[model samples]
Each structure stands twice: as structure tokens, then as C-alpha cells.
Target chain A: MAKMHVKMTVNGKAVEALAEPRTLLIHFLREELNLTGPHIGCDTSHCGACTVDLDGKSVKSCTLFVGQANGAEITTIEGIANADGSLHVLQEMFREHHGLQCGFCTPGMIVRARRLLAENPDPTEAEVRFGISGNLCRCTGYQNIVKAILAAAATLNAEKEAAQ
Target chain B: MIPAPFEYHRPASLAEATGLLAELGEDAHVLAGGHSLIPMMKLRLAAPEHLIDLQDIAELKGIARTDGEGGGEIVIGAMTTQHELIASDELARAVPLIREAALQIADPQVRYLGTIGGNVANGDPGNDMPGLMQCLDAAFELDGPNGRRRVAAREFYRSAYVTAREDGEILSRIRIPLPAPGHGFAYEKLKRKIGDYATAAAAVLLTVSGGRCGSASVALTNLADTPVFAADAGAALAGSDLGAAAVDAAVAAALAAIDPAADNRGPVAFKQHVAGVMLRRAIARATERATERAAEQTV
Candidate 1:
């Protein structure tokens, strides 16, 4: 098999890499782009640790091939911060709320939660639980993870209203 | 684990895709979302020499309700993702069961990447859409070297990992006739947890008129080699008030039709019981909704 030249916008940065058609998007992000925030918890799609925002929707990076994602815009955990390198609201909430213990699934959780809030800015407790059901957090027992997401949604919504 | 080496081809049109498939022959496999296929490739269960990516084919996208000779029909592109199906209000209004079932498939992330075409075409017994499509009486449109054709969803599956879709043909679109207005629908699935395949699932679409069942369709998932249509079970509820007797007969018919081989879920008898329970729940909810719809129309 021949390596294909793949180009895409990752975290608002243009990146071009040569990868085999069999190379997964998770490996491409970790190895080529050096975006290690998206951890590969389970190679299979069961664990959502490799979740990334692809074209505005959350997708498991481990299950997608690099060649198939060519020419698409992608956002991993690293892209969720502010332009001046400040923690995004979701990250801040995670720290304030103690959303993680071992921190292995933190990046994926924060990344997916940001998208969830973006899609449903005012999610209820049950809705928040269901929205992030795909992303697992074994450490916090999901109590604080859910709290952090809800807190982030409130803060983000408040900021939006204040800006107006 | 990484997948084995394979050449990737992105065809821009259906003709190009079919040409690639016909040219590559047995060594080629169509890639639609790749949620299932990629994992299989990683496990070395499927090692195709050529992988035809269908993402670039513009024609294999979108959802629209078009008028046909028989009535209204919802035509969904094969590459439409599960998320797309859930988000399409046209489809939701025409056939709400599609949304009900799509929400139960995998999870939000998987739903974003998983395509309905791949779900129905892959012949995975655990997939939710095939059984629901049978209940909706949807037709799959295929494009191959021999040109275009349609196959009824009820008759599409031959066995697990086998279907009526020909080797060189690509499922281009799924056409579902709009259910009669005031139709009731529900998809009841009993899985161990979220994102898990159903222990047993049932889809029901029914229309009630004058306190009696006018028509009904029931389909079961992961209870057999293929999605079971449960024709006898559906017949049992037709022209009845959806009474206790009618519901019991339908459940019995559904239990008899299903041939579930228990692996981790439960024993054969346990799965059969679960399947019957799912059918009864689906039928009850569907009938209730149908009766409500019938009452609303009279006003």
C-alpha cells in the first residue's frame, strides 16, 4: 500500500502529512500532528476517549481512517482553549468541580462536553447525562463530570448574554 | 491494533464508484462511515485490497420527501449519517420511528459517524435500523454495473452478514413510503447499557380506526439470523382493539418466529422471553399512540 498525502485543518491549524491508507485518525493526530490530548483508551469504538469534533459533530477518532478524513476540518482537545492560551470554560469547570481523578479521560470528556454544550446550551441534568453518555469517566463517578458540564453551560450562556 | 494495508479510492459519482467496484471485483469493499468496517479491518476479519470511500459522492446524500404514485415517500441517501436521520424533521414527521431507533444506535459520537446505509447494508444482526426499516416497509435502491434497482427491506437480508445487495452494487438510497397520517410507532429495546446492542428489540407501526386496529407491522432485532418481520404477530393485531388477547397472540407469534442464539446476553429461553416482552411493549405503546391519533383526527 502507498502512503497518501493528507491535508486538513486541525485545531484551526493547517497540517499536511503522509500516511498509509490504513493509518487511523487517532494515530495520525497523536503521531504526525503531535496532538496527544485525544487519548486512545480503547482501540474499538466502545470507549469514547478518542472523541473529537469533526465538522461540528463528535466522532470517535480511533474508528476513522486518516485517508477518509482528508480535506475535513477537525478539532481535538487542544483546540478547545482560548486563542491567548487560557483554559476554556469547560476546562476551568472541570478543575473547579474536580471532574477527574487519574485524568486519563479528561481531555476527551472536556472536548466532548464542549460540543454537547454547543449543541444544547441549556441541557438539563438528565440531558447532560445522556449527551455525555458516550464519554466515560471512571474516576469521578460522573457526579462531578456532570456538574462541570452543567456549570460550564451556565457560564458560557451567561457570557453570551452579557456580551449582548 | 492497526488495519492491514489497503488502497483507498474516493469516487466522486455513483458511476465512478460502481466502475471502481466492478473493476476491483472481490478485492474491493465500499466504505461508508467506516464505524463497523474499520473495526473489523483492525481485527483482520475483513482485509480488502481496495477500499472505496463513498464520502465524496454528492448524490449519495440528503433527505427529501417526494411524491410518488402511491403517495408520499421519504428518500434518504445511503450515506446519510444516523445523526442526520435523527435531525431531519421531514423524516421525523413522515416516519418518527426512524428517529426513535436512530437515537438508540451506539452513542452520540458513533451516531455522528455511522451511516444508515452501512447499518442496514452490513447485515449486522445487532444493528437497529434494518429491523425498523422492515417495520416501515422501506425499499433500498442499489446501483451496480447492471444499473439501478430496488429491493424491499423485508426481503433484503439473507442471513447474518449476507444480503440481497449484489457484489458490485452500492446501496444508493432508502425509499420509505410515508406512513398513513395518524399512524402510531415505537421502538422498544432492552440493552444492558447505553450504546450496547439490544438483548432484544422490537419496532411497531400501527394505525387504529374506530377503536380497532386497522393495520400493524412488527419487526424484531437481534433475535434471528436476519431481522424478523413477525408477519403473523402483526396479523394478530390487525382488525382488533389491541386487546389483551390480541397482544398475547402477537407476542406468541413473535416468540415463535425468532431464533435467537444466546451468547453473552442469556440462554435461548431467556432471549425468547425478552423478545416477546419487547414486542408486547412496542405493540402496546404503538396502539396507544394510534388511538390517540385517531381521536385527534375526529376533532
Candidate 2:
């Protein structure tokens, strides 16, 4: 396999990795870069377990080749913490609401949901369901996840208002 | 499931991409978002020796519309992601039907990674874009060693997973004319679950003028080897009253037009039933929206 040189900013840090031509972003992040926060549930793009923020959108990293993402800014679960190392609102919400059990799909779920809430802060229940439809949770019928997201939206909005 | 290895080329320009594709011939595939292709590649269903990545081709990456050119056509770059398509206010207002379809595609993650070009270029009967694209009467601009050419959406798909594209050709843009004022369109898809492939889907576009059906188009997905355009159903509605009786006739014809095959999803009979139900619902929803717009126009 031929090798390729890729340079990009991942999770607020500049990272460079040399990889094969067919190296998927998931494998590059996990094996090459050792950023295993992004899990790989289905490498075939069916499961959003490999979700990560690329450029400004939440995308399935498994579908992306390392070369395809050259120079693009990316965010993963590892970046969701504040400079003080506190969990992000979505992370906090998921934990408080018991949004996950078994936790295999939690990272992708929170990453995807954070972007969703960013775009639509006050989305209805239907919108929330559609927003995170890509991220599946076999455990917990998802009622609690929805509740957590709604709760996070309220907290974020209140915090913004308070700061203003 | 890891995909079979392939040589990857990230061409910066359309000319370069087309030239590389020509050099690689049938063994080459264009990588748009790869939400569709990568999965097939991993399943070992498609093993191209060369992948000409279009992500670097900046020209094919955004949605552009111009209201200044008298009446305008929405020109969506071939590699525009589903996220971009759904985000465009122009698409939402000028042709909300496309956004309606975009909203139901896969999920936020897949939509973020998938491109509209890949959705249509894959030529899968199960894909939601084809039926809607066909109903929009869209056109494709192809660039190759022979220069650029255009193909209408209706003529783009030649067979199962095959298109009219030449070995070296690359789709540059998808162009759709502004739909009629007060036009109402809806896309209805029934899927097994979130992020799962839709079992059966329908895209309906039509305009009701003064209580009469001025024009209508009904297209079905996953009911055939391609997005089947039910001509008789639209023919039965065009220029007629879009009342209960006319809708009934069109629905029946549209259902009869679909020849669904048995798959893991369900039996052919079940698919046919769902197709009819979805078609009916899409038409009804589209009509209801049309009525609301017409009422607004009078105000």
C-alpha cells in the first residue's frame, strides 16, 4: 500500500499522520493517532458510533478517508471538555439523565447531539429524534436520551441568558 | 468490514479529476462523500482499483441560486453535502421538496458525510434522491476529456447501478428550475429505524390551480431497479380536478405501476402496499401545503 502524508487540526491540536492511501479516518484516529474516544461500531457507516465533527458538521468518520479530510478541522469526544477539564453540557446532560447504559455508543451520541443542539437550541421532541437518528442506542428505549438533550438545551440557554 | 485497497487520487480541479478517471477507466470510481460507496466497497460489492476523490474539487461543493436572472434555476454543486442541502434557505423555499427529501435521507451523521451527487450517482433504487430528482426534472452537467455535456434526470440512469456517464465523466452540478408558484411537494419514506435504509419511499410534486390540478409528478423508490416514474398517475391528475375522485384514480394507477420485488425488508406484496400508502400520503401532504400557500398568496 502506498503511503500518504496528512496534516490537520484534530481536537484543538495540530496533528500530522502518515498513513496508507485507503486509511479511513476512524482507523487513523484510533490506531495511528491513538485517539480512541471515537468508537467503531460499524465500519460500514450504518452506526453513528464513529461520529465526529468535521469542518462544522457531525459526520461518520468511517466514511471519510484520511486524505479526504486533509487540512480540515475536526472535533471528537475528547474536545468536549472545557479548559478547566469539566464535561461539556451534553456530556453532563447525558450522565445526569442516564442517557446511556453499556456506554458503547455514548461518545458518538453526545458528539452528534451537541452539534444538533448547537444548530437547533430549542428543537421539538420530533426534531431531536430526527437530529440524533444517526446515533443509535440499543439500550434504553431513548426516552431518557431525549430528556437529557432537552434538559441540556434548557441549561445552556439559561447560562447564555445569565451571562448576557 | 475493511474495504479492499485502492489507489487514491485527490484532484484539485475538475479537469484533473476527469483526466485521472479517464486514465483509470472502469476500474476507477469518483469518491464524493462516500457514504454510499464506502459501505458497498466494504461489503466487497464494489472494488474499484482507483478512487478519484472529488472532495478537493472546490468548484463542486456549494449551493448557488440567483434571483436576479429573471426566473432562476437552483444550481447545486455535485459534491454538496446533504447537510448543506438541508441548510440552504433557498432550497427550502424555492424547492422545499428537495429539503423534505433531504430531511429523510439517512440521519444527521450520514447526511453530514453524504453528498447529493453520490445519492443520485450511485443509481440505487433504494436511494431517496433519484425519485425526487426525477420528479424535479433536474439536469446533470458532466465534464470529461470530450468537454462538458448535459443529461436530463429522466435519462441519467441507464440500468441497475449504471448511468449514462462516460468512463471519464464527472458530474459537476445538478440544476433544477424553480417550481411553479404555490407548488407543494412532499417526500414520504418508510424505514425500519433510524439510519437504516428506507424500505419504500415516494416523492410527489404538483401544483393545484383554482381547484384544478395544473401539473403533477409521482415517483417511487425501492419498488423497482430504479426510481420508477409513474406516468399514468401524473397523467391521470394533470389538467384535472385534484379532488377525491381524481386522487383516487392517480393513487390506484401509481400503485399498479410499482412492481416491487421481494427482499429481506418484506414481500413484494407488502412493498407494493407500502408504496401505495406512501404515494397517497405524499400527494395528500403536498396538496395540503399547496392549499396553505395559495391561501397566503391571496392575502
Candidate 3:
């Protein structure tokens, strides 16, 4: 099999590279572009550690080929910060609430949580749990993780209201 | 666990896809969502020489309502993702059962990429959509080198990872006849967790008239090599008041149709027990919803 030319927008930057058709998107991101924010925990689709926002949807990068993602726009944990270099509300909430212990699943959890919040701005505790159900966390036991998401939702909503 | 090297082709049209499939022959596999196939490729369970990706094809996306002989039918393009199915308010209003069942598959991230076509066409016994489609009496439209054809969902699956879809045929869309107004539906799945496949799941659809079942359909998932359309189970409920005895009979009939084998989920006896329980719960919920719909119509 020959290598394919793949082009995509990642983290607000256009990237072009030559990759094998069999290369997983996670590998393409981490190895080719050096964007290592998306971790590969299970290397399978079960663990959401390799999750990234592709064309506005949270997707498992491990299960997608670089060729399949051609021309798509993607976002990883590295792109979730504010333009001023401050932490995004979700990241701030996670840190304030101690959403992680080992920090292995934090990137995936926050990436997934960002999409979940964008889809539903105001989510309940149960909804937050269900929203991030795809991303597994063994260290924090998910209590603080859920709390962080809810708190982020409240903070974001308050900001919107204040702006209005 | 990287997949073996393979040539990749992205065709922009359905005709080109089928043409590539015919040209590539048995060594080629059509890529849909890649949720199921990619994992297999990574584990070396499957290694196709050519991967024809259908993502660029415009014909295999969207949801629409078309007129049929009896009533309107919902025609869903094969590329329509599970997340799209759950988000479609029109589908929810027309055939809410699809939305209900799609919500239970995998998770948000997987649903974002997992297409309805892949779920039904893959012929994986563990998939929820095949059984749900059978209960809905859906038809899958396949586009192949020989042109287009439709296969009933109930008659599609021959065995696990095998279906009526011939080689070089791409499942283009799913057609579901709209259920009667005021019908009740429920998909009761018993899985270990959110992303796990169902150990035993039941899809039930029924309509109530004058406190009795007017028509009913029941299907079971992950209990055998293929999704089981429990015709006998459905037949046992028609015209009944849906009493405890009638429900019990229906459950027994459904259990009789399944040949569950021992695996990671459980033993044969446990799977059978759970299948019966899932069917009973599904029937009760469907009955309740049907009665409610009937009441709403009367009001």
C-alpha cells in the first residue's frame, strides 16, 4: 500500500502530510504533527483517551484512519484554552474541583466535556455523567469530574448572562 | 494496534463506489463509519486489500419522508449517523422507536461516527439496530453493480457477520413504514455498561384499541447468531388485554425462539432468563405507552 497525502485543519491551523492509509488519526496527530494532547490509553475504541473533536463532534481517533479524516477540522485538548492563554472554563472548573487524580484521562474527559457542554449548555449531574459516559476515568471515581462539568456549565451560563 | 497496510479510495458518488467495489472484487471492503471494521482491522481479524471509503458520497446522507401505499415512510440515507438519528425531531415524531433505540447504542463519541447503515449491514448479532429495524419492519436498500434492490430487515440476516447484502453491494438507505398513529414502542436492553453490547435486549411495538392489543411486533437481540424476530411472541399478544397471563405467554414464546450460548455475558440459562425479563419489561412499557397514546387520541 502506498502512502496517501492527507490535509486537514487541526487546532485552528491547516496541516498537510503524507501518511500511510492504515495510520490511525491519533497516530497522525501525535506522531506526524507532534500534537500529543490526545492520549491513546486502550488503543481501542472502548477507552475515550484518544477522543478529539472532528468537524464539531467528539470522535475516537484510534478507530479512524487518517485518509478517512481528510479535509476535516479537528480539535484536541491543546486547542481548548482561551485565546489569552488562560484556562477555558471547563479546564478551570476541572482544576478547581480536582477533576483528576492521575491526569491520564483528563484530556479525553475535558475534550468530551467541551463537546457535551456545547451540545447542552445547562446539564444536570446525571446528564453530565451520561454525556461523558464514553470516556472512562479510573482514578477520580468520576465524582469530581461530574462536579467540574456542572460547575463549568454554571460559570459559562453566568458569563453569558452577564454579557447580555 | 495499527491496521495492516491497505489502499484507500474515496469515491464521491454512489455509482463510482459500486464501480470501485466491482473492480476491486472480494479484496475490497466499503468503509462506512469504521467503528466496527476499523477495530477488526487493528486486531488483525480482517485485512482487506482495498478500502473504498463512502464518506465523500453525497447520495448516502440525510433523512426524508416519502409517500407509500399505506402511509408515509421514513427513508434514511445509510450514512446517517446514530447521533443524527437521535437529533432528528422529524424521525422522533414519525417513528420515535428509532430515536429510542439509537440512543442506547455505544456512546456519544461512537454515535457521532457510527452510521445506521453499518449497524444494520454489519450483521453483528450484538448490534441493537438490526433487531429494532426488524421490529419496525424496515427495508434496507442496497446499491450494487447490478443496480439497486431492497431487502426486508427481518429477512436480511443469515448469520453473524453475514447478511443479504451481496459482494459489491453498498447499503444506501433504510426505509421504514410509518407505524399506525397512537402506537406504543419500547427497546429494553440489558447491558453491563453504556458502551457494552446488550446481553439480551428486546424491541416491542404495539397498538392498543379498547384496552386490547390491536397489533404487535417483538424482536430479540444478541441471543443467537442473528437477530430473532419473535413472530410467535407477537402473535400471542394480538387482541389480548395484555394481562399477566398474556404477557407471560408472549415472554415464553419469545424465549422459545432464542438459542443463546454461553459467553462472557453469561451462561445459556442466564441469557435466556434475561431475554425473558427484557421482553416482559418491553411489553409492559409498550402497552403503557400504547394506552397513553390511545387516551390522548380520544381526548
DockQ of each two-chain model: 0.91, 0.75, 0.92
Ranking by lDDT: 3, 1, 2
RMSD per model, one decimal: 0.9, 1.7, 0.8
Docking class of 1: high
Over B1-299, each residue of candidate 2 has an lDDT whose tens digit, in order, gives 67788888888999889888878889999999888788788788988988888888889988887665657788999999888898899789889998888888887887876888988888888888888888888898888899999999888886678888777788899998888888988899999876666788888888887877789998888888878888888888898778778888988998887778898899988988888789889888988888888889999
- Candidate 3 pairs with clashing backbones: none
Top lDDT model? 3
Compose the digit string of candidate 3's lDDT tens values, residues A1-65.
Answer: 67899999999999999999999999999999999989999988988999999999999999999
Model 3 bad stretches (over 4 Å): none
Considering only chain A, what is the TM-score of each predicted structure? 0.98, 0.97, 0.99
Candidate 2 lDDT for residue B18 = 85
Q: What is the TM-score of each candidate against the true structure?
A: 0.99, 0.96, 0.99
Error of 1 at B299 (Å): 2.5
**Ranked candidates (DockQ, high to low):** 3, 1, 2
DockQ for candidate 1: 0.91
**Model 3 C-alpha lDDT per residue in residues B85-120, reported as the tens digit of each score:** 999999998898889899899999999999999999
Model 1, CA-based lDDT = 0.92
Top candidate (DockQ): 3
